[model samples]
Target: MTYSRSQDSPDRRAEFPQTDLRGSIDGLLNAFYQGTSKEAARYDLTTHEFNLLSACLKRKEECTATELARVLPVDASRISRIVTILVDRGLLKRRRLPSDRRVVMLSLSEEGVELTTRILRRINRNSARLMEGIDEDEIHIFTSVVSRIVTNHDAIQNSE
Candidate 1:
């Protein structure tokens, strides 16, 4: 079930037969997310919850649920639910904009900030370990290919 580029033939078409390429990418993402889920659980957070927290940490600005939905893959309703859970857990602060009471802005609480920082350090260390053997050129090429794949996927989705 594992994939290796060494298994590919000289023909570029054979470099990634459709099903094999899809399977390889799926397998890689599933494995990566499994690890992430385990790590997030250690902090009493689901992968999605951790992602929301990380997004808040990165933005460092109070953002609306709609803004989060735009940046994240999750829909607005899901973001709202997660935000509610986070707010209840005291990991997030929710406030209405004075100018617009209808707009609820979200930011991390102090405790949330501390926990997120620790988790980020661990994630950064893990990522560094994951990239240990890979050179910068290989990383660049991989990133480029992934970007193209994502673009192609978006095009396909839009066509549908």
Candidate 2:
């Protein structure tokens, strides 16, 4: 689960749907995520692990476990488990943050970076294929609709 910073934008949030937005959204995601997972398998990476590694690569330094949990939309305990696996696989290094000893920081290993880069490239190519025949305007409209839902969901979460 890569953390999308765009999720914080009011224009990109979403509310609970009175219609079947959930189904539509899930279907869209499942198709893409499933394909991405198959591509990741060649590198022995789980879908979630690949996503987390990619997110870590976007940063200049290690991220604390709490940050991963919050940003990835996973519960803290689950994030902890995932981090442990990543570390055991030599894909990540876990250490105490210099500023806060209580926080565990995560950073990728050299091999981890290479592996993730490959996976990202493959996934990007696969996604491009899916959008190949679609017009740019259509893609823009689709993305815009999804952005609105994200904004509504953010509003719902904030109110709660």
Q: What TM-score would each prediction reach against the true structure?
A: 0.82, 0.80
- Cα lDDT of candidate 2 equals 0.80
Across residues 39-142, which tens digit of lDDT does each residue of candidate 2 receive?
A: 87888877777778888998868888777767786788877788888899998998886888887778999988988888888888888887888999999999
Superposed model 1: Cα runs more than 4 Å off: 1-16, 156-160
Candidate 1: tens digits of C-alpha lDDT, residues 1-160 = 5665666665854654685677677876776777677778998899999989999999999998898898888998999899999999999999998998998889999999988888888777777776789999999998999999999989998999
Highest-lDDT candidate = 1
CA displacement after TM-score superposition, residue 61 of candidate 1 (Å): 1.3
Residue 152 displacement (Å), model 1: 2.8
How high a TM-score does candidate 1 get?
0.82
User: Which regions of candidate 2 deviate over 4 angstroms?
Assistant: 1-23
